[model samples]
Target: MNGKQDLSKVSVLLVEDEAFMRRLIQRMLEDLGVGEIVLAQDGGEAVQYILNNSYAFTLILLDLEMPRVNGFEVLKYLRSAPDVGNHDLPVVILTGHAEKERVVQAVQYGIHGYLVKPVSKADLISKINRAMTKPPIDASHLK
Candidate 1:
């Protein structure tokens, strides 16, 4: 992709537990010109997928609350796992909780962006564009 408008080269791992929400986000991503999307129902599944295919995704759209492992845990794992080779991967938190504490915590975890529930396409695209422009997080900074 040459510019923010062209996400044709972008590939994402969408980790969401809700089936309906997952489909909705997937459609939005497709509309944004994303080339590939890998789905994970929960954080544990996301972890497994990331481990198996570390370099496959250009970004991750992670849900904060899930049945197994939650987004926070997944973030920690990604930061700590040397073998995964994804410590710098962009992760945008997608959550219903917009509480100050939760948002602060996510920021501390080095999330690229945070999107509240009922996300609009415009907001999503803007956030994605902003995140994509930033330099990848250095794993050493987390420690």
Candidate 2:
């Protein structure tokens, strides 16, 4: 799939703690022709943004670790919050090489996909396409 064309109308929420990585990913998203990219430095800020904003996001690219709320907490909130209306929203986890346990937990939480740190542009685009086209995850089993 051509990411630039496919993503042209899609808005994304990027939750990353590191400044450099965030900027890098933002550039990659821009290059892919993503419509609007909303950035959150950490999970706390991301949750706040989700609560306050009425705009719908096409996808969420989230880092596993952060200072305040952490990605897992954010994922749980998204899945469980009655008013959020984003339980089915596609979420892709971003993790380092050592975070195997976290990745497993994220899968149990119904993550759409995941990418290791220092993600390549090709991989990012590929994952985004896959997540966008993949069927929604059923989190009811978790209850």
Candidate 3:
């Protein structure tokens, strides 16, 4: 448990429709000592949740392809507002993809970072820590 724990210190918003995938990511974040976890069944819910509770989340792990409101749409929604107070929230796309062009496109869209699906708890923890603590490409640079 080196450099780990204090679950009451971190909060996460998990946006995934797949119940199993959501649970898995939740468990992984929890194991990393996230204090609170917000579960959004779809992109619509995720957006609303962020609007209503943006201040609570230290990070958001989003999935690219989802029903109703895909991750791209959600990101667009967030960017369009610019008032959610989460414009800088660490959002890491967790998906089962590794296409270079797709990744670049995502980066162009202002994603804080990304991790392939089935991401290990350890990797999640590491990425989570880095995303929240590091200086992501300045918000001003996002197109």
Candidate 4:
């Protein structure tokens, strides 16, 4: 995409439990020229970091399966938490499997998009572009 240069201003919050996967994705993002990337070990850590630094991110790449808190809980918090400023913040799920029920649940909770495991840099860029172009999801009704 022509926006590779534009990615220099983007800040991404990547939430993944697996260290190897996390590093791999981070490196890809960096290679794509994302300006700032923050790492969270799991949903629990991601939530805490978001609570304090919600404004620091332009996008969230979330992993559903986690040790604690989990992606769904974080999605609930983002969509319903009174303290959250940007309820419509762009979110992309980084999932290993695209289960029907899980996808439905995620959409109901308001994810912008999702990427299957073993993400390619091209796929990552495409998802990010699509998510950014779309308007924010109003999942307040789901609360």
Q: Mind giving the per-residue lDDT tens digits that candidate 3 earns over 11-124?
A: 788999899999998887777677899999999999888888535787888998898999888887776687576676778887888787666767766777788988887778
lDDT of each: 0.84, 0.86, 0.79, 0.86
Question: In model 1, which regions exceed 4 Å deviation?
Answer: 1-4, 135-143
Deviating ranges (above 4 Å) for candidate 2:
136-143
Q: What is the C-alpha RMSD of each candidate to the true structure, in Å?
A: 3.9, 3.2, 3.4, 3.5
RMSD value for candidate 4: 3.5
* Ranking of predictions according to lDDT: 2, 4, 1, 3
Indicate the residue-level lDDT of 124 in model 4: 92
Q: Which of candidates 2 and 3 is the stronger one according to TM-score?
A: 2
Give candidate 2's root-mean-square deviation (CA, Å). Answer: 3.2
lDDT, candidate 2, equals 0.86
Evaluate model 1: give its TM-score: 0.88
Give the alpha carbon lDDT tens digit for every residue of 1-102 in model 1.
222487878889999999999999999998888888999999999998899854488889999999869999999988788878768888899999988778
The backbone clash count of each candidate, in order, is 0, 0, 0, 0
User: Which pairs, if any, clash in model 1?
Assistant: none
lDDT by residue for model 2 (71-95), tens: 9999999989997867888998888
